[model samples]
Target chain A: MKKISILALACMLAACAHYSLAPEGAHTVQGMSFVSTTDWNKSSLRSGAKSEVWTKDGERLNQLTFIGGIKDGQTIFTSRSKELPMPEFRANMLPNELMELVVTSLKNSSGGELVIDATNLRPQRLQGSIGFRFDMSYYDSNGLARRADCIMVKKDDRLNLIIFSAAGMHYYPKEAAEVDSIFSSLQL
Target chain B: MRLLLSLLLLFASLASVAEGAQRFEPTLPPGYAPDKSTDEGGLWYQVERFEEQLQTSPHIIRNTALTEYLEELVCQLAGDYCGSIRVYLVKNPHFNASMYPNGMMHVHTGLLLRVANADELGAVLGHELAHYLRSHSIDQWRNAKKSLGIAAFIDIGLAALHEDLHGLARDVATVGLMRYNREQESEADAYGVQIIATHGYDPAASVSLWKYIEAERGADKSKDTSSIFFATHPKVENRIARLKQHIKRYGKNPKTDETDLDEFQNLVVAEYEGLMDEQIALQEYEQTAEMIDRHAAIGYPDSLIKFYRAELHRQRKKFGDERAAIDLYRKAATFERTAARSHRELGYLYIKHGLNDAAKDAFESYLEITPNADDREMINFYLETLR
Candidate 1:
């Protein structure tokens, strides 16, 4: 049961368009540019026009997601069905509301199995715009405990965000410093 | 002789009509084990592996006392089949209790939060047990296999069995494969009522549970029916009417029947706040508001209800909501149990409104109440900034 059939794996692969190598140093993706101190593999399965994801080992191990220039009424994640109640971004949202939006969006995206605990909300600057930062800890689908650091800013009535998540037991502590450095180098 | 045999068959058919169809009996024997060569056995193998994963899942509430309570309650309802069942109380904020063919049962926290009494909880659990006893999931699986061929069936099974797959994929596969037919649902509903009434629980509790759910569903502006339980089950109004009919047939003795509200509340109080937090996180304001009010009507502490009400207001942040939240939080802070969290929220609101002195006071009160709070450093930073 642990091993998914090759056909099922192929079906999953078909859903993804492709992957590209995100080499070390400065790179522009979507609407923002950032400098990566290390090489990473980027998924071509963008959720929207302004969102992209990069991974070091695999998506389950560690992932860095960039969502940029999401307009008001646009959801943080792309939902397939109109019935799904994905939270929309609003320009007038307060700092705490933004955190809630992310939490709700993630919960909905995961189909409510994930138990997320978000804490340590504080203000930070992201590419010269005042933004908020928070930490979240939750278990993934495979019951692996994971942690994420998220930073979001509102610029020109649109939302910009970066989230780096990794397994709490090992990968998070191993890659946290590099992730922080990369986040620091983000320019919008 | 042939004429006599035909008359006897006709009489049997007439008797069945008089009884309004034969009642569904449990097909599963106690401690039943299917042979490995059979398709049912293959399904069991898949489920047993999923159970292994579930055992390690973070979502499983590990509270020994709560788990024991639920197990005992299920044992009471299950009777001879008790030994075959294993109950898992999952920390999910959705109203659901699901039963697997292999006798693994999951009771979600949201259901616990919503149920008014142990009898209501028993009603829901009994319904799930009825499904298990009737082997509804297996029947549905076999039906799907007959219609779709073996290859497609295995694909559906593997999609549900794969741990690496996203929840949406798994849910779609599971819902499509395990959805019981209308007749099976009615059978289970009838059995659920019969079992609870036999156990001396108020059969009307089943009707009450459905009515509450129907109202809660109506309260939601978005009418989001994404919950697996809501999606896979029959319509709530229909369920309510049918349950009422069953209750009427089963009869009720109000003075003698047990609700066990006190015991249910006592056992679940420890997990209440966390459960409410998860519910609030769904961001379904009107529905959550209705739930909070219903919980209040059940006699949960006013302070706790007020705090959650304030939290809903704070999170929703509609026009003039912050003021309403401030008022509620201020009221809640008068109670010792909720004082610390209320102060913390008040601090955040005060800071947001640029009332620096009030923010400092509220934060200090929060720190004093919860000296070792996890966010102490962050609170201290805010205090320094205010100075």
Candidate 2:
């Protein structure tokens, strides 16, 4: 799978990715921007310009996905992979329904059944806008436990989402402070 | 020595019973416990651990009355082995009912929702019980080990060597053995029909049960069966054919008297809305609509069924769905036994179509019913807009 990550990097680069390099500084991605506490690798992996990935050790252990400016009828998962059906994200979807879409995406992308551990839904401020926040723990199909923190809001019939997910054993707690800081620095 | 002799005799007796024949009494002889020193015993111990986890798992449905109802049904079907069997109702939306070596069965809510009547459910319960009666799990474990052509103890010793690795290996094995072979499944089917028939349930219901599954699978195009190793799967087509043959051959007029629709509804109607919610979460709109219609046709609460029908229309949002959704939501909201969310949703649909007076009344009713709803602010905003 690590070999797949290397191949993925080459694939993204050859696919006309928009790359931003910074030594632990602020970054503007699509219509949303955030400051990173650590030097992060940002690339258009799924959808060019509309979606981006930031990771420390690639997506194997820890990663942050930025799914921004998705139109009213667009789906959150932009994977062109035809392996599994994609879950859609509609503008009129309730907060809980949108979260269900996220979990469905996680399961479909991973190609495995998932067991949710905890779900904490709270009203949180996102890019100076009132959005919903979700802190969740779940086990992936590979029996790898993970934690995800996400904030999502809909504006002008478009979805702006930022998700931070990492291995629950050590990586999640280790990088939690940085993720929190980055979330705080978000602007739309 | 006595236990071994008894096991041998029991297996020989079970093997002697022919398919589509009556008078096959399923009796569990004394001394069925495996020695802890054996590899099969190790499997049993692992299964016990799984049972323990299942007992406290959040996915377990703990509704006491429902649990008691299922227990009684299993007891009726199990007969001699009734005391040995245990059933767990899980909240999963897949059509499955699994039995472990330790006589622990996990029946999914999907199975309940799919089965049209008690007799259909009885057929499933009886099939799972038959697996336990015939000791298929132990046989499967032995077969798997043989198929791998590895010494069972070598893997057992490795499992004993590392506790964590053993846990992981157990999980993998559990997933691998989720389904039984075609022969075993066929035998279980035959045995289940006989058992339910003996217990006064219509044996013909088994045919209808598989028909439902076949129809559901036929409608689902996304499920890729190309790579599936269904070598031993009684392939739904063959099973339906064999089941019909068995029903004819058994020839005892396979009692068709009791449908038990009322009892089935009384036990399951309260759970339809919640199970439908799980189905909708997967965003399979067509499948969800089919399920709602099936239940509604068979007389589930009109209020809940209409609400879900409205939700199906609203979420799918086809050209005419929004208008249809408004009508259904309004119908659901007017029902006496409605879900509180129905009125709230009706209010939103009303506001969407710029019907302020109707929207205001719906919002007020929703707030009156659910004062502490989480989306209170959003509902209030709609109400203010309507004002």
Candidate 3:
């Protein structure tokens, strides 16, 4: 009976640590609504409004992130106890500046752990609002090349962003279509 | 007041040295290696593991010219012992250099950026080499092991077994790995000047270098100059006087010693820009401004420097900053190799001040210059709004 109770507590703790996001229906995330066409495991994020992870081969090799309703003067990265101050996210920041913010955040938080390269930006329409989309190629700490597709939009004095990323090899190619479908299903 | 205090401390250090301390001799001769069965060999093996890991670290700078220059400078200071020591340049933005037990020295880019010329670089390298020659890490490790053994024994006896205590153990080990006493630091400082004198580099540059560090610390009290070595050493104020004493003892005529300013700038300026970008990203505007002021006064003008200057003003947005940014951006754009985003930033500033015609021109120029920029759609949107 004691062993059973311990097992149940461990299961509960695991569930609390890794939450699942419903994939078959629309979800409102921090005032931004979107529909996920594929199952993704929601997890606590250090930054951004909401975060989810997708694993392959028993490892968390892919991630889907949503940053919604970021207010003016707020930063896109989390504050650390003894870390240097971070740059704030201004509502009027240009797309290039926004890109720099993401790159800088990755570099600063990683302590030069990650190297990122973003390619040309394309026009994207999110819930009928004008937005910009870009693709990035980066190397993680272990020198694993990863690819990501991101969209950024400023709406009603708030910034909403979404990024879907996976390992640059087989995993990214396998999930690329599903990621595009998920982005296509975004709604206001 | 600080200068006076430093002088008094210098006198104190010289007076103390008159206690007739034995001069240190290098224990490890040229091409020395420990036997595999000994404890020193065990330490070397562990350090080899760390060196392997460091080789794969993303922060390791891999520029061939830069690495070669650093190794050459280190070798110049080390002389006969040069063959056994390996130098690794790291990309951390703090002013520090460290030597491991296995003759591996890691020099941070921050230290590289802070030094004005080759002699200053030699001073820092010579100090680190002094630590290596003396094998201070072995002493630190032995002392740490003794304390850790006692702590572990007590903890085990008390049956205070908890998962949290594992982290405590790691913290204790890390702290023990460093924390050399004041005696080791003074020895290293004194011997470091001897190495500089032997190499025909300016020994007084050590004093000047510490003063530069002192001035930087005074400018921004928040900046951490502490490294593995500085964390436990006596205050910089005391060290400055000791370094001055050594300079008086061993310094060559300034005209006879080599600064190698031209070669240092050539090898370091390109990397300096990248390091400065890292600083700008840190949002420590005051530190970056001080760097800009120092470099600009030295006449180190380049497109990247101008762009960052404009970026500094633009980010602050104080009174007249917008106008200053505009002018600085224009100057930066005049350089044929300026960053493409400078025009885009110019467009934003022009639009904010209701200069639609100028905004359009700037946006067009930005698009033309960076036809494949990642933010084309947004720039186009701005262009449409301006039209």
Candidate 4:
């Protein structure tokens, strides 16, 4: 009986472990397809059904987040309390407004401890749709300087966003080219 | 002459009673430092390490003039302890000011934005200074250590040693451990009023500050009072009442007391736009609207306030917000001192409303005002399309 219970517990633990190593290949997630140039680990921890996270090292070192098909009136980030202000997506939002939403959401996520500066707002094309791109650099609460490259597009009254963030000292420059390739290969 | 002397004696007696009733006094001597072997010393060492990290934080406002202005004001309030205190103006959009036991003080931009004038600012600084002088943080740390036990206390020390003392660990070491009880808060409040009154500032300004905070909190539909400042400090209404009592007991000439409004405005103008930008990004529309209204009521320039009002409407985008934003933008653009970006925003609104000619004209005005605008290329693209 003890052996049987131990075996059941092992299976339960395995079921709870949802993180998996994602191979370098083309894959579709939430109606968006992208080709990964390198192997990365996928995390089950996500904000909602439309959001997913990937990491090479831990999230603090390097992270890639895909927030896809977010409908209007839905928040880009989930906060701990409903009372806390989080910017909601609106279909008619301009490029700058969209950028503000993302920036504000990131600040709210960090409880105002993250000091971020966003600059170089320009237009780009993603998945054959007109979108906007920007650069963001911030210091985490630990005083680690980090940088992110973000691209966002709106399609069929829904928003799609991709962000690749890493420590600015070494990881960002090291992964820039491969991340740019991956961003270029995205299809929504 | 006899009547005047009697009045002075009466005032002195009342002041003595007020001070005696508080039943607390400053424990730290001038140029005070803790013995390195004690628990207080350990806490100060950890905080000093955090201070080193804070110095390099990008969020710190490095403007020499602005920082010097704040430092001078703090010095005026701190008196003999001025040499020991160091002030860091952090660019956060939350109304908070924290004093570390190690004499590192953080004055958030939000607090600056909220206070009407120098007197209100002085009141807050005096309160924080009182906490430092009373050694409230060390007392609270001892209480926390006793409650949390040796195991958790060791964990805190280990976290500090590993330099992993950030986020939750940092909060535990600093804000969490320094949380004061109600009696301590009342004592601080009493001293804050008395100190400001002594410095020729109106003791009533403290009451006004708390009242404004209460009104701002009420403006939010959810009435979220879970902010770190609100959580750690006494309730706004309770603090206001206690402050009123202190003022009644201590104020020599409350009505005649003057606040340096012009000096405060002049010093803050350089950072006003950046402050507004950070506040607007928070997206707490109701509270921000209330703050802007209160700020305008305090006699800030109409042009700047109008632009932020327009920005609030433009970003929230509720029913009728577009029309409100357009009206405000037009009004703001009429003022010569308004930010040139007002025209850019008006141009975007015109484009949204399908008024291409107006959009073209607005964009041209933007270029005329700010020829070297960073987004000049983007504006030129819009103009080309309109043509």
Q: Candidate 1 residues B1-387, lDDT tens each? A: 999999998995575344333455789899988898999999899888878877777878875776888899899999999999999887777777777889988788889878888888989999989999989888988888888888987876677677542352346346466677776777788888888888888889888888888888889757657655676677888778767767777688464533455777767676678888888877778888888888898888888899999999988878998999999999999999899999999998998788999999999999999988866766777898799
Q: How high is each candidate's TM-score?
A: 0.87, 0.75, 0.84, 0.87
Better of 2 and 4 by lDDT: 4
User: lDDT tens string, model 4, B287-354?
Assistant: 89999999798878899889999999999889999899999999999998774778989998898899
- Cα distance off (Å), candidate 4, residue B146: 3.0
Error of 1 at B155 (Å): 2.8
The CAPRI classification for model 4 reads as: acceptable
Task: Find the candidate with the highest DockQ and give its number.
Answer: 1
Tens digits of per-residue lDDT for model 2, B136-173: 77787777766655665446534432333213323433
Q: Where's the lowest-lDDT run of ten residues in candidate 4 chain B? A: B161-170
Model 3 ranges off by over 4 Å: A1-16, A44-60, A112-115, A118-122, A136-138, A141-146, B1-15, B18-24, B150-173, B222-230, B253-259, B316-320, B339-341, B370-378
lDDT of 1 at B385: 78
Model 2 chain A: worst 10 consecutive residues (lDDT sum): A109-118
- Candidate ordering by TM-score (highest first): 1, 4, 3, 2
Give me the displacement of residue B98 in model 2, in angstroms.
Answer: 1.2
All candidates: DockQ: 0.40, 0.13, 0.32, 0.35
lDDT of 3 at B323: 95
Candidate 1 regions off by >4 Å? A1-23, A26-35, A70-74, A81-84, A92-94, A123-131, A154-158, A184-188, B1-25, B163-176, B224-228, B253-259
User: In model 2, which residue pairs have backbone atoms overlapping below 3 Å?
Assistant: B182-B232
Alpha-carbon error at B45 in model 1, in Å? 2.1
Model 1 clash pairs? none
Candidate 2 off by > 4 Å: A1-31, A34-65, A71-74, A78-84, A91-100, A103-150, A155-157, A163-185, B1-18, B22-31, B151-178, B222-232, B249-261, B351-361, B384-387
True contacts kept of each: 0.36, 0.00, 0.36, 0.20
Error of 1 at B291 (Å): 0.8
